[model samples]
Target: MKTLVIIVASLFAGVVLSAPTDSTTKDSQENTYSIKVSDHGVEKEDTIIIDEEKNIEIFQTVDSDDAEVVEDFDAGLEGIIPRNGDSCYVKPLNSGENIPPAELKSRLESSGSENVIQEQGDKDDDLYVLAGGPIKNRAVVGETIAEKCEGRNIYWLTLAEDGHQDQGRVKRSCYLYYCSLRVYLGKGRYYYHCYIVRYLC
Candidate 1:
């Protein structure tokens, strides 16, 4: 009886060891795997198939909202005009004259209350004069003036090329003021001498 049992155990062990390994039967088997991925708050599911030759094929399914296309829009400087009841003034730009801050403050105060500085041009319009030579950072100065005096019809006057070419005018102007008009004065070969004038609302 013992000999028979040992023979049976030996046969069972041989059969288990000789059984086909997973790799040997892999070609006859097919596997399906599901994978999930999330990106930018969107979740997606993918299915993979392993064929007999161990080649993988993938298919993906995504929600309609996740695949949607979006567009961006930008509106620059549109509808930025000052509202009603806002006062406007032209801050003068004097070339080569360094007016003290105290003087400027006093001038602004006097002008605000008494309107000491008369309008340069037509009563209905405002005129700013840029009298001297070419100014440095003309664009930057114009932008600053425009921001300070809003809701006003502004004008800019700069010396023409003829005046800038004259050598006798030893005084060089820097940082002159210009109007708030959205006019594009091409920065000519010479520095621009411009003025910014603001009309009262």
Candidate 2:
């Protein structure tokens, strides 16, 4: 009788332990700022949803065929120019004229501008000379002049005839044009134009 009683007691204990215990759960929801992307630009109208269960759902009709999209990130690139530097020899105009760097330097020196500057690039493809200086006379006829004092950003280079000819032609034609820009790095921002004919030789 005692053994039977013990067995019945053990069975009852097991049944009680297996019964469902108390459980309390909490539900949480939140809104996060988000934007939808389209070909035109950025559009923001809805919020991203997140629950206490770590589940996330975003409601948006984004165009997958968009040209570009930028995520949440930041980046950039850097470049610099020397205090005294030269630019690569770009064709002065849209026309054809092959002038040697040495000849160009000589022509610039003759301008008679104080502090005539010439900076050569270390590489062959670099601009051989960036020659410019102050001119005594700011006012001239048919010439473009730049002045930093006046908060002006651009001016023109003067063009005049150089008596030397490149090939069999005694007088090759050189059309002069005025050029100027505001963002020059040096101290002074004035220069005169020098004209020379392009010789095929």
Candidate 3:
């Protein structure tokens, strides 16, 4: 807590101190703020741009995804949805539509999002999921994950967005140009997210 206060204080002081030295109108409008920290011989800088008129801020990390908002969920394996036996539907299943986790994961396999599971007697595919997050726009989720696929084949380019209970299936499908499927998490507020389907890379 103390360290955070110090950093915040330093940032505030720097901004105020620079106000008089910088006279360009464009520079004042930029509202671009950067903070650099040195700890144990390691130095890192983060840039944050604030748009006062829009009441929004964009955060840019040194070498990571640009997060529009600070997310309260994880982005690892099954970050959006975990691997549990109990199944729930993010969207109303058809009278006979029952898509399980394994099948859903299979659709996204080419995405290179799966991490091998070490369980015995289970075909070595213990767990699989399409995971990455905290990005502002769901539309770019696919684009963002594509950059992380080093040399592996990208079979899936996915996008997950929240679905309001009032929205109809067709409306949602049209929103995503026909989403392949939805993955419900084990338990959490984000269990209602729908993960869009296969856009190969």
Across residues 1-201, which tens digit of lDDT does each residue of candidate 1 receive? 111111100000000011112223633343443333232333334332323332211122231111111000110111112233232222333323322223322232232211111112211112233333323333333343344334444332433444323222224432212211111112110011122222221
Would you give me the overall lDDT of model 3? 0.24
lDDT of 3 by residue, 94-164 (tens): 32232333332233222322221211121110011223323333332232232332232322223333322
Model 2 CA deviation exceeding 4 Å by range: 1-25, 42-46, 52-54, 62-201
Q: After superposition, how far is residue 137 of candidate 2 from its true place, in Å?
A: 94
**Model 2's TM-score against the true structure:** 0.15
How many clashing pairs does model 3 include? 1
C-alpha displacement of 50 in model 2, angstroms? 2.1
Give the range where candidate 2 is weakest over 10 consecutive residues by summed lDDT: 7-16
lDDT of each: 0.24, 0.20, 0.24
TM values, all candidates? 0.17, 0.15, 0.24
lDDT of candidate 1 vs native? 0.24
Candidate 1 TM-score to native:
0.17
Question: Could you tell me the lDDT of residue 85 within candidate 1?
Answer: 28
Model 1, backbone clash pairs (residues 3+ apart or across chains), number: 6
